[model samples]
Target: MLKDDQFWISDDKAKLDMSVIKGYLARSYWAGQRLEEIIERSVQNSLCYGIYRAEGQVGFARVVTDDATIYYLCDVFIDEEFRGMGLGKKLVQYITQSERFRNIPGMLGTRDAHELYEQFEFRRDGDILMRRRPDHMRS
Candidate 1:
């Protein structure tokens, strides 16, 4: 768990607000075509991270990993009202630098957040994809 006052990110799916997640994704360019059933199944099959405050869920991200060689970080978003607060970086940092994933190489797709993820060593792979090297652990 990563904390910032009352706002924190947890890897507990039960703590997630499916509505907020789905609503956000439903309007996202990358995930807009995804259906509720698809989102639900993805959460069930991946490790979900939900960011919350006293209000409710405000951000989300999920990781598809094998715990041994690779991982895929996807569906990342921070609520509009929560933007400009650095929560996205905090969330990505928490996931990438945590004990379980610290040394693991991973991948993510972002339409325009390259500079943000690049701070964590995620370099370009393709048009919308970025690859984090295996050495992308916190120093």
Candidate 2:
């Protein structure tokens, strides 16, 4: 987990530091399986992947949306060197503005970050969402 500092997510059209971004992805759990594979899968699946860089890559997130009225936001991460700087919140803001996600119902999971999501109007309605881990992955 990233410490609470030195990170910032941006919606600006700034040049991305791909090398650093790749480094972070390479160290991620499931994503570390293969950077090329992960990038390709994200593109093919129509998932929007965002990376935060400050001196290096500090955060990442992917949004699954249909360019319509429903969006499943997932896989948000902030590198250990960068956290608590609002990068994750900024990334969510950036993704929500897309024509595909604007006005759509968005959802995500977080062991933490409930406060950040609250700023975007995300709420826990008990009936709003649920999940089941793959049987094979369950302990």
lDDT of 2 by residue, 64-132 (tens): 767455577765666676576667766766665554565666777665566676666667545434232
- Tens-digit lDDT string for candidate 1 (1-139): 8778878999988899999999999999999999899999999999999999999999999999999999999999999999998889989999988889878988999998999899888999988999987764545
TM-score of each: 0.95, 0.59
Candidate No. with top lDDT: 1
For model 1, the superposed segments whose C-alpha errors exceed 4 Å read 136-139
The local lDDT score (0 to 100) that residue 105 gets in candidate 2 is 67
| Each model's lDDT | 0.91, 0.57
Best by TM-score: 1
